[model samples]
Target: MDSGDVDFAHTDEAARKRRDKAVGLARYVWDRGIGGPELLALPDDRLRKLARAAGANPPSTRETWSVVAEMLDEKSRWAAVHPDDPRAVPAHADEKIMWVKPPLPPWPSR
Candidate 1:
């Protein structure tokens, strides 16, 4: 779908950056087969830091990461049905209607 096909408010730069980072982290861990209980057990601060490093707006509290997780799972399902439409994923958590491919940055190795 063309960018114009979706009608939604644009996300500000900072928020978009944050969302991108979060998505990247989620994608990275998922791609590495690192998730489920192990992921859920991560400390909120660690998750927040990872999200921040990934470019996502960090979750304000421990409970907030679940929102991103849910979004990721939903996007995965959506992609399964519409495999060709990767852009169907939302660009920001606050604006689910507006869609964009979540940026996937290279993981930072220590």
Candidate 2:
């Protein structure tokens, strides 16, 4: 195959990977009870931070994700519109949540 064709294949693979990651981040946030309205209100930077916080497992350096992924997620278009009163609500709700994790095996775990 020509060099151009090889480059296209690699580009396509990278695009697919990015798309999958964006979808995963969205689902993770939604499962955390953060939906469309709240999502739309957040700036891309804050949203990416939120996504990383909500990640099942996230990488360290690439915390903010890519512009391409943000665009695909429709977050790039969401400009950070500061609320008239930023302090209107508590950052965290008062409710308590119980999270469950699998029990550690008798054998050493990763």
**Pairs that collide, model 1:** 18-56, 18-57, 21-54, 21-55, 21-56
Instruction: For candidate 2, write residues 1-110 as lDDT tens digits.
Output: 77556654247676676566667765455344343544455565665566556663442324224432454245323323323443322233221121212246798769
Provide TM-scores for the models: 0.39, 0.38
Residue pairs clashing in model 2 are none
lDDT of each: 0.54, 0.46
For TM-score, the strongest prediction is 1
Q: Give candidate 1 regions above 4 Å deviation.
A: 1-41, 86-110
Ten-residue stretch with the least lDDT total in model 2: 93-102
Error of 2 at 71 (Å): 13
Residue 47 displacement (Å), model 1: 0.6
